[model samples]
Target: MGIDYRGLRDPNAEYTMRDLAAESMGVTADRGGGRDVEITDVQTTMVDGNFPWTLVRVYTDAGIVGTGEAYWGAGAPELIERMAPFLVGENPLDIDRLTEHLIQRMSGEGSIGGVTVTAISGIEIALHDITGKILEVPAYQLLGGKYRDAVRVYCDCHTETEGGAGPPDGKPTGEDPPAADPIAVAEEAERVVSDLGYDALKFDLDVPSGHEKDRANRHLRNAEIAHKKAIVEAVTEAVGHRADVAFDCHWSFSGDSAKRLARALEQYDVWWLEDPVPPENHDVQREVTRSTSTPIAAGENVYRTHGQRRLLEEGAVDIVAPDLPKVGGMRETVKIADLADLYYVPVAMHNVSSPVATVASVHVGAAISNALAVEFHSYELDWWDDLVSETVIEEGYIEVPEQPGLGVTLDMDAVEAHMVEGEELFDEV
Candidate 1:
């Protein structure tokens, strides 16, 4: 049987941009669909646990729906709900246009780099999912084909036993009680590497309880720095040549102190030193990066490509870790990676969401040549992958799906089972 390319155009007869722009743009009928898939409704729900997981779903007139998750936050669901009206009648396939429209529409709402962008990011991801499903392609293809089939994943792990002791909120903690000291941290690293098969891993280096100095001053006492170094040294030494280890300071130190800490940890040969200093001042970050042999990675808290562009253009950090769902979704993430590519920088996705966003990051990770690895923060949460129909990540890599959209349908049962108290699933729509 011969291939019927036109059969692949938007199945809905109610829409037809194909006649005008399809052939001229070299958009084969199979790949030119979804442009007419109009948004019918937008809805959000929250899941209670470590953080309030804000999930976004964009329903289209074509019966195709896309799901995305805003990075965990207080106003994410409300923010998405507020922006839903603007998106109601627009085309989910006009991803870039819709993204800009939302940005412009909410400009006065303080969307520069906060919950506003997170809301937009969730919506943007859903749009890509819709467009991909409509066109029968993967989300990465929408970003321009792919460079790799499997994206490496890094776990944001910890060694602390209890709350207020480990990586803190927004990061995962498990029932496997925390180990005692640096030795325990090493044991955790060994288990993660040997048992879990994750070649790259990260742990927090600046947990308050681990250090002795005052948190307000941004200055690190010698003992505090030494304690931080001990953690790094133990983890790296334990994993020795088996896995690459990274440490996160979470923007806890002053520039000078951060540099000193970075310089001190140089002997450990860490994979990357993350957010040693705060992210506000690029010059200071750049100075810290230049001062240390350990690679500096930052920008997870940054909102969109614009924020990352500033850091990349200034050579602020060695590696940029954009939280894909939080950093303006798939397209913006690809844009950020492309911009970083020009500067010969690599991208390490800062992920903390469930499988929906994990797979979304996999798509972006597949498309970018310099993508180092994507974070997997749900190792301890057994139900994390249950939220989706199938497990998207196994071992330490995501096998990019050829199936359309984000390639995973929401297991509503799993979602409902985890819903936050007093929250209804997509009830607003």
Candidate 2:
């Protein structure tokens, strides 16, 4: 004797028939009137390009799927697979619980930082994508709504025509390419600012300018420092006040050398000097920041909030640049930003993945008032926007979409065309 469906729909009741039907027909638990949406499977693939792009897909019982990407590196796919078993059967909407569960479960596997955390970040972002879709709201809403309609973007311009060549291991190509050398870099910066409308840009300053810097000890010769200064001078002169410029050393200098370089570049009114020295020692970075009037940015290689918290609390850096997808997905990044906000520190996201991760970072930057800017690493990749259904960047800003989830779908043709050697698109194990 099953209950009669016809009698269950009382016209006088507060809830609608569709809502009641959704609950009685498919809802898994009594926690809410919504469907449970349990995780069914997780999949990953590596696509080669400037760097290997590690993409993750999470499937649920309700037939909804969420996509995300991890930072390019070895063993992240394997790490995601290792963490997938714990996520199976859990509610996709229980994002915080699930994120903490994965982190706690992988604590033994060195989840404190490195590849393990990166793998979790991919899954965590996918969970946000899933949650946003299930709730029928934009991802920014889950982060407590947005502070701005569009997120400001900063281009990572280089002096090279990278897009004209054949795809590197089948990675996507770009439209117009920018080229190297101080003069060439300055020209490219002017073109990107005036033509592309990018108001902010960064360049790699570690390349030797016909001067030998001790590579082994990370020591800069006087000539090397002067040459680097010359490049900055040329770029600053080119852009004038149209754009804010920052130079990246990629942790290529010793503390003494980094201090020397930072002081020399202060005259250019640079945005910030990035990762001039190794980030392992906070005291060293603090000393460098204290010694320079120019702002110091670091922490892209650091892991989670715990990893970056010390740097902020101890006054180690003026700008905190955490690689969102690699550090800890959306929610964690928001938490990281909030923590930094308390210390009066501005967040500048360090990005190097595909559109999936880049847009994810945009949603995060939109939610946090302390976010200064998000990095655009694929300016020269002509097909960078083709990987997604539509272009997200217009002019120099990423317009936040009002659509549910991440607001973009993967272009399967583009993805499959650039899939890494011997990989499949979310193929089940």
Top-scoring candidate (lDDT): 2
For model 1, the local distance difference test gives 0.82
User: Can you write out model 1's per-residue Cα lDDT over 1-429, one digit (the tens) per residue?
Assistant: 333322223424444454435455665532225455568788988887566778889997788888888889888888887787777656677788778878887898888789899999999988888889888998999998999999999998975541243432324444322323677788999999999899999998766434443456678888778877887888999999989989888888889999999999888879999998887888898899999888999999777888888789988889999998788888888889989999999999998887888899999999889999999887888788888887687788889988998899888888899999888876422
Query: Where is the poorest 10-residue window by lDDT in model 1?
Result: 2-11
RMSD for all candidates, in order, please.
7.2, 9.1
> In candidate 2, which residue pairs get closer than 3 Å at backbone N, Cα or C atoms, i.e. clash?
159-179, 159-180, 160-179, 173-382, 173-383, 174-381, 174-382, 175-382
lDDT of 2 by residue, 14-35 (tens): 5645355546766532323345
List ranges where model 2 is wrong by over 4 Å: 1-34, 161-180, 427-429
What C-alpha lDDT, on a 0 to 100 scale, does residue 112 get in candidate 1? Answer: 79
Look at candidate 2 and tell me the lDDT of residue 309. 87
User: In model 1, which residue pairs have backbone atoms overlapping below 3 Å?
Assistant: 161-178
Off by over 4 Å in 1: 1-36, 161-180, 208-211, 427-429
Per-model TM against the reference: 0.87, 0.87
TM-score of 2: 0.87
